[model samples]
Target: MDLPAPLQWTEHVLFSLLLAVVVRSYVLYGLTGVLKDLVKFLRLLPGVDTLIQFILAREVQTFMNKVSATPVDSEPVKKAVEIPEKGCSAEELLQDMAELKALETVTEDGKVFAYVYTMEDEHAKTLRKAFDMFNDPTGYDGNDKPSARENVVNQFAHTFLHENALSPMVFPALRKMETEVISMVATMLNGDSRCSGSLTTGGTESILMAVKCYRDRARELMPHITEPEIVAPITIHPAFEKAAEYFNLTVCHAPLKPDFTVDLAAFEKLIGKNTVMLAASAPQYPYGIVDPIEDVGRLATKHNLPFHVDGCFGGFMLPWVEKLGYPVPPFDFRVQGVTSVSADVHKYGFGLKGSSVVVYKSSEIRRHQIFAYSSWPGGLFGSPGFSGTRPGANIAASWAALRSLGEDGYMQKAEQLMKTTLAMEEGVDSIQGLSIVGKPAMTAFAIMSTENSGIDILALADAMEARDWHMERQQLPNTLHCTIMPHHIGREMVFINDLTESADEVRGKASLSSKGTAGMYGMVAKIPDRAVVDEFILQFFDKAYKL
Candidate 1:
């Protein structure tokens, strides 16, 4: 069987090549099998079992704890042995409401920041009168009166309440009010006549609507996209997180620069084929610093994704501020690529709570915001928002708030608010231990203590509370926050004086301790596992309803 030397060499080479192919194929197949098994094992772990359960548990626990720990409602009402068999008199109901109001803790005497947006007695009376005037009109129920069993205020209480918005003939007034509100807001935000929107319950609903609209639009335009995502700065409201959770969208949070503005490079890197929306805040909630919306708009244009400006906090402030000659950025439909915006009327709009608007640049895009069901026994039902039946009173109140505080009034209020805010900013900056977080061009601002100041901002907040001033404490960088309102204009000096004294007192303490919900927030910030924080939030909600 011996052959020539060349032929023998060729035969050997052929055998070696065959053996190499077999070995390589087996190695590749084994690696693939191992990877599949590893993925399956990871998926089976308890930690990854049910994300919904994990997330909801933490939120529920935190909520419960808050409800339970509220000290104002110490006496639980007991059931009566027999019914009165008749409705209570109006006077009796009024008396009961007054009693309940008296039981509420007065934390608004400058002791708390951002919650109440306290007003002077005269202003309070005015607001009350306005509220009473429309409380029964336009078919809206009272918010929290004397009775708990009354379903009159349960969103849809009037005869026209259950009428379907899907059919314009059934609830024409609802559609009209909704349209007018959107038009008014759009005009205020410098949108063209073509701009349109729908009324949402609040900022979160508005945000969710925008997300869903953009997601659907993207899918229609680009059929291959299977996974959609949103790119937002870390400072954007947590409502976006809720939207992502509910819509099965991935949220990529871009980092903030040292000054607390969105990092442009990081934002760009996070964009991919599946990114359907880009979000920027006009004065984000944490530090109240407006992002570079013009730049973000440009990025959105380049990426061909919808740009959403979340002006829930500053929607009413920015236009007036700009008119006041403050250095403001373009944050509305005027900016190209800014397709949608969410603004809350309850915040700065001075409307009663539970009203917000989400506007889009064009009615074409807004078509996606509508929800419809064609196959129900109740007939074809459709609504613009998540709720089945919304309160017409809120709509009416929103209209009244806007009409009452016309452009002139809003401008004046904005001016006063800016003055107060500037004064507070200067006061905080003058303090040895404190520094302003960012250049707050609007009414909202934050302050943090330096290491040299020997003051803990959280402790300072607690001390301020002792002085009957309520200021919010923020974590990420450990700061104190304030949102100046019309009522705070004249009281600026009082707040400054109290804050100065509080800082001094906090500085004297060798160690600081946070109590109550403030302590919970501090602890939640330090926890590395977000799941634990979620549980704490849930507990707070649960505690809120304890009787």
Candidate 2:
């Protein structure tokens, strides 16, 4: 059948070209469809426009503000300029800020379930007053001498500002406040006299500091090991992963059980020679189901490893949740092997956003978190974690919040929230195709769909959004997240009613169009290769920065 050899070769080449063309055409067509769908979906997202505006039009700070201004707020500069110029008047600045505020995504009065943690109006006013009073104290500075105008600033600074605590004699008042804050938190978490910790910027910093301490501890214990690993449940906060990335430690994530808590056996197995620390969230974020921390703690004790309990989301609430007669498990320092614990005063603690406490069982281990260097020209520099300047105002605010809330205040809030959570859970379960995601341990929970339900969970989320309920959409079995705050106390019926109506609307309309956010999420979930998803997110981040 071979005619001339050259002619046969040419025929083979032509067939190969034809096949390439056909594949290229098919790929192009598929890609075009995906692009269109993504575009449509992004446009339909509720806050995309507002988010873009917020990022672009927000006030930009200048270096002058950093070095000048004792309180920084008295003469605020709107933006950094390429060249020096006259600044806008106070009236002009106020008008401009109003414009930016106007761009905020307007939601139904009580429908927001994320980001803005609203307090009672009176409580919020109290925070505002506290913030205003000490808004500009420098934690990094001692300010031994002051001008007449700076006298008040120094008083507040002396009361709360001591990032390094160079000498207890120098700033005894500041040192005392910090000690009491840690002691109170440690006592709440079941730590005895051995417990010591630092007040950090927030949960992220607290976590970062904890990871660093553990990493350094691992280094001292096993100097020959080149790599250190942190083992945590898949549901642990991203901040832990951020710590791993920042500290050059590897993270081994243990998968979850059917109940959404860490698979204890599997988690224990993930621990290896390189494993330096273990962490588990108390009432993990997505489902709000607490891990078997006591079991995990036992493993830590067996392995002679440091364990950290992340109660950032629920730390302030769980103790109260247990007090309120819920079946709460042992998650705090009461667990035998827990060496460190992080709790944010901002979340359920109802403190300002930038405050959290990370406590260690002893100063011996806590010293690993301190950064000290004497060789540099800047005299014996010693700081904890990674900040040169801590925001003293946040510390002051957190102290105020804790003192304001007291034990009775927190329990009152927890009781109110738990009731609302139960109502929401009950309402979700009553829906034809919907169900609550786990035996949620605290006020946070998620809603998912039944296997036989024809309704798409994502589409249901979209429908709820249409009703002005900005529920947080989540994946790994797609669901909507809800964190019941004080403001959300009375809105359970509204949420349930809206959710029920939305489920009904989306039940049979899987192919109907309002599936923008859900559709994108579903498509992303199907892609087996995570690199493609990473690329998509990178592009999304790029677009976010574009004006």
Each model's TM-score?
A: 0.70, 0.71
lDDT of 2 by residue, 39-152 (tens): 544555698867765654444234323422122243422331110023223344334334422433332356544323444467756765665564432221123343222333
Best by lDDT: 2
* 141: Cα error in model 1, Å: 25
In model 1, what is the error at residue 451, expressed in angstroms?
3.1
Q: What is the C-alpha lDDT of each candidate?
A: 0.72, 0.73
Model 2: residues with Cα > 4 Å off, grouped in runs: 1-172
